[model samples]
Target chain A: MPFEEKFHLRIPGPTPVPLRVQHAMNRPMIGHRSAECSRLVQKCSQRLQSVFGTRENVLIIAGSGTSALEAAVANTVAPGEEAVVVVTGAFGDRFAKIADRFGARVHRLDIPWGEACSPDALKSFLLSRPRVKAVFLTHCETSTGVLNPVRDLAQIVREHSDALVIVDGVSSVGGVPCEMDAWGIDIFVTGSQKALMLPPGLAFVAVGPRARKVIRQAEAPRFYLDLQAYQEQLEKETTPFTPAIAHLFGLEAALDMLDEEGLENVFARHRLMMEMTRAGIRALGLPLLAEDAVASPTVTAVRGTETIDATALQKELRRIGVVVASGQQHLKGKIFRIGHMGYCDPLDVLTLLSATETALHRLGKPVRWGAAVAAAEEVWSRV
Target chain B: MPFEEKFHLRIPGPTPVPLRVQHAMNRPMIGHRSAECSRLVQKCSQRLQSVFGTRENVLIIAGSGTSALEAAVANTVAPGEEAVVVVTGAFGDRFAKIADRFGARVHRLDIPWGEACSPDALKSFLLSRPRVKAVFLTHCETSTGVLNPVRDLAQIVREHSDALVIVDGVSSVGGVPCEMDAWGIDIFVTGSQKALMLPPGLAFVAVGPRARKVIRQAEAPRFYLDLQAYQEQLEKETTPFTPAIAHLFGLEAALDMLDEEGLENVFARHRLMMEMTRAGIRALGLPLLAEDAVASPTVTAVRGTETIDATALQKELRRIGVVVASGQQHLKGKIFRIGHMGYCDPLDVLTLLSATETALHRLGKPVRWGAAVAAAEEVWSRV
Candidate 1:
């Protein structure tokens, strides 16, 4: 059995937190406005700018990832504005819904669930919209395990429309490279739970000068989600509100781990894990939800075949103390997802494959002992 | 010396978490939508309702205390509506500001900084603002350390105005008795950092039937702050957004501790600590910001005199590895606040008082070496 509590967590988010990070978060609480907390906030915020690939300061909000997503919408598009959202999966639909909730006329450029939105498609979508104020894109759609080409889509948005390029990098940042300035991303948002190797609480938003200026000018009804207030407070080396202080402690440790590993190596490791997971699943004759060209390095969705029930497979895996995520929204019970980000390792992936092979065979599928594990081992050795 | 990390934490919020709760939070991460997570959420929320003194479900928000305050305002007051806000201190002013940000015509019922809103004053204020759609009150003003007479004020609101009573119980709920239904408060909110013995991340909002109805009907633009959707998903024993799972683990442990202590005993313990703190401060010939009757049980603010500088005294205490809160906003540097809630014992308070005494003497005040500690001990023995 896996240590520290029981089940092996292989979800897209709320990923495994390292022991160092957990120990860091277990430190005693301190005054939020004290000098020590100020230093912690400033240092953590500074270190995070590198992961986001932005020179601008990242605003840390003590909220869920969706709070950052909603903040992006609430600060930019005012009532009666026109915004374009690329809908590729559940999170994409969420951005569009958030925009619509904020009274903006949202034009969703829907792409196939398992496919990335092409640059040409985004360009044509923007051309038709004519007066789009902002364009929202998901860097990694967790629901379908599709990694949209955000850089290309953002370039198209810049060339075709005078709109703010907002990208939800909730499941992308830290596990992958995000060149916010280079990609012309006006606003980029990410969560702590995915590749940051911390639990879910903090949401980081990197706002470029253009987005900050627009946020300052926009007259939206927001007090807690106000980004401008966060900026003003950051100049004082403190937060606008009481931050998730323990999470910051964990964040400092997580950042140290990421720094020690080096971000480039971290991304490469995630890629290797992804390759391992895909190979093992494919060796079991499983159907992948996303094309290899557009597959997410963080999470891989494996569709259930007619012979195998995804629900039963998930349940069997759970019985063996292996926990992978089931499909979300409309795809529920039809597919399962394997997470390969954050603190996950090759040995952990091998164990998961070994367990999955047992689960499938136990669920009346053809017996294929050692095949899945061997396939993953082959990928690991090749890498 | 205080163990775990270093200094003694005496801030009003981000209170010192118990080691047990910290250990609970340090448990391994798990899939957010798994059956185990759902069970944790249900059990934690169920245990929390008793502390809130409500039969309604206490919605757990993965955000700051400010987020819950804003959620209450956003869910009830529509744009261009009229509301009455009783501004007693910083938090009360924050509620008024949130209403103003949300485009409501807010009539501020300003009270003196160190005083609570009297029922007569509130009745008169409500009578004058007959068309007020909602009335916002702060149950505990953390800045001034004033615990308002919420039960009485809420009664007056029900009698005099057709307004929904929304209370910011951020610093009050877990430390004091909050009879939400009996007090006629339509909405009540608190945070994990205060008397909950957890870090600053989760916000709990207990919504009454009236508030829920109004929230569903209110036309304010919100997605992440929308409480109705939270209720809908909660029927399935899950949160609408990804919750702070580690905090939920901590919450379960904290609630277990609270339950084991028995809530009445917990409240009395906080009361005893308050009496000890106030006695110790008075014994040192220091002035308290709030009067004895309205002084908060969770925190107490000590004002500076002509002979002593509050800032210098605070720095001296910090030199001895003790941490307390400086006054916020206009009161900064004039007063230093001592928190006596959550995971704190009489021994902690005695140490805090003793450290405070040494700091006062070092700051050139005529200090009797054992006077403050003796006074606190007397109170503890009597209680």
Candidate 2:
């Protein structure tokens, strides 16, 4: 039965958009330069600032999370300038690559996959590289389901070096607590997809005063991804180019949903979902890819066993209308992932765990039929 | 009457999205890496090829029109290599600027603002610059409502130089006739906001064999706008990054609408709409910005007289719940544009013309009360 009619999307992003958000996107598109568009953008920016935990307005771009990551590098770090990029997984590697592509002399601090970057190690690296202009790190490495110590890393950068602390908060911002202003993050980049509960298209970059100053003098060959244009238009409460208007409408609705639920409650819900997913995995005799201390609240990665083919398990789950993500990059076929981010709740996690258990048993792996569900239900009931 | 609730958007690129397309965006989002996603992308690619009038697959990027223009330069034109950028209007100048930003030695062929780049002039320039790696030209210069002869110019490049002919069809592809394969064009770039009848956020670039070969060997510093990554993933029927899935859903529906109407019929409708708009402007005693021979079929630019302030006219139109675009760049306040592109019909054109005449009369410009509407209706009746 193709499951095409109604499938439970469990991928990291293009995460499942809520029905309200989808209906919001059904609204008519306003002209990008119209006063209506300006008002909508202004409202969205203010709400995004609240979600980002920042006082400054967030700049929205009509691209993916990667574009926002590139903007962080292209806007602040000039050619031949030094920046420290901490690589924990695929997304971290991507951040460093974008910096390198923009001609920044990058000091790559590579951490093992499924692990978060240590603040002390990053500080040591910054100490060695005294003239670093920026430090790039991922808050939640989506590829490995590990959450880096962004606040500690930002503090280390503040104490050790005069470098801008730029974070790729693509998968963590709305789902987790990221106080950009209180944490002294110079630049925080995220996408509308993951935890924002919208489809992939709009990327938001919240820039602090220090990064804005650097952007004024930064020499990068950029036009479309230029932050200055976005910044200038943002002052007028509009975007420089044509934005993804439908997505912005969806964003407005998604933000309303988030606000109604309350941000703290949203964070707690994500944490609970992650805990339930982890407990369910443990009950099914599956090992998690990330350590409990570093496990992400947005997505959970499960290590694949020899007996259970991760790809086949994913396929089996998809057949029954559950869609989880297979591993990415080097982790392909080594681990499978279940995304509990954006528009997800306890019931969704329970559904995923139940479906996973069925797929495992059907694939001739284990005999724990309802163990995973019971474990997940325990976490839900306690919450 | 705030007009904010129901304003008619008549901009060139962001033409009004149809009801069906907007409703399509309300559908549930599937995982971007799911089998369903592959099937949808594959179907979208095939339909996009038909719309773009190309045999090759069109690469879809989750960005605005400008990003696709940047991809054209960053993918095929290496830094320090010579390329000819034919400038006719604001978008034309933008194309040159993007190439210059990428460190290309740009030989700019600047034409007047409201005039199309002459094929003979481009041929002469290509003859002089025989070693030019690429030539950038705008198919429909939206800023001034001028349509450059892409077909004739591509022929000139073939006969005069081995340079890759790259055309920015951002506002022209789906509205008018652009035979990519037949015209010997190497690369044709467009956006989803225009005649595609979808909202902004998706950009399409159709590359021919020669351009693909050049892209494989080009040495440009890029990551997100990298065509090579997109080309590689096109084989797998997926995008390299998280795409604007909601926009793609809208795009699929928009393409279905275009297919239902038929491409030839779509072109004819655009042409008729343009003729009607021009006739209305003439009857209102306003001169067109572009000459009749070079005028665009998607949008019509009318020169504002002293009595009729372009900004005031646009504002007045908006007050009556009709929104038209004012001129861009240096032409701002000197002219106004009415987009007759996607999702627009004869009735819409008549309404725009009637509203324009009302605005002109109220602004103290001596416009005959129903002359503009009668002229437009005359053309519509004949059609």
State each model's TM-score restricted to chain B.
0.98, 0.98
- Candidate 1 is scored at a TM of 0.98
Model 1: docking quality category: high
Clashes of each: 0, 0
How far residue A197's Cα lies from its native spot in candidate 1, in Å, is 1.1
Tens-digit lDDT track of model 2 for B97-163: 9999888999999998999888889988888887898999999999999999999999999888889
lDDT of 2 at A370: 89
Q: Write the per-residue lDDT of candidate 1 for residues B155-185, one digit (tens) a residue.
A: 9999887789999999999899889987888
Worst 10 residues of 1 chain B by lDDT: B1-10
Which candidate has the highest TM-score of all? 1
DockQ of candidate 2 compared with the true complex? 0.77
| Pairs of residues clashing in candidate 2 | none
Off by more than 4 A, model 1: A1-4, B1-5
Worst 10 residues of 2 chain A by lDDT: A1-10
* C-alpha RMSD of candidate 1: 1.5
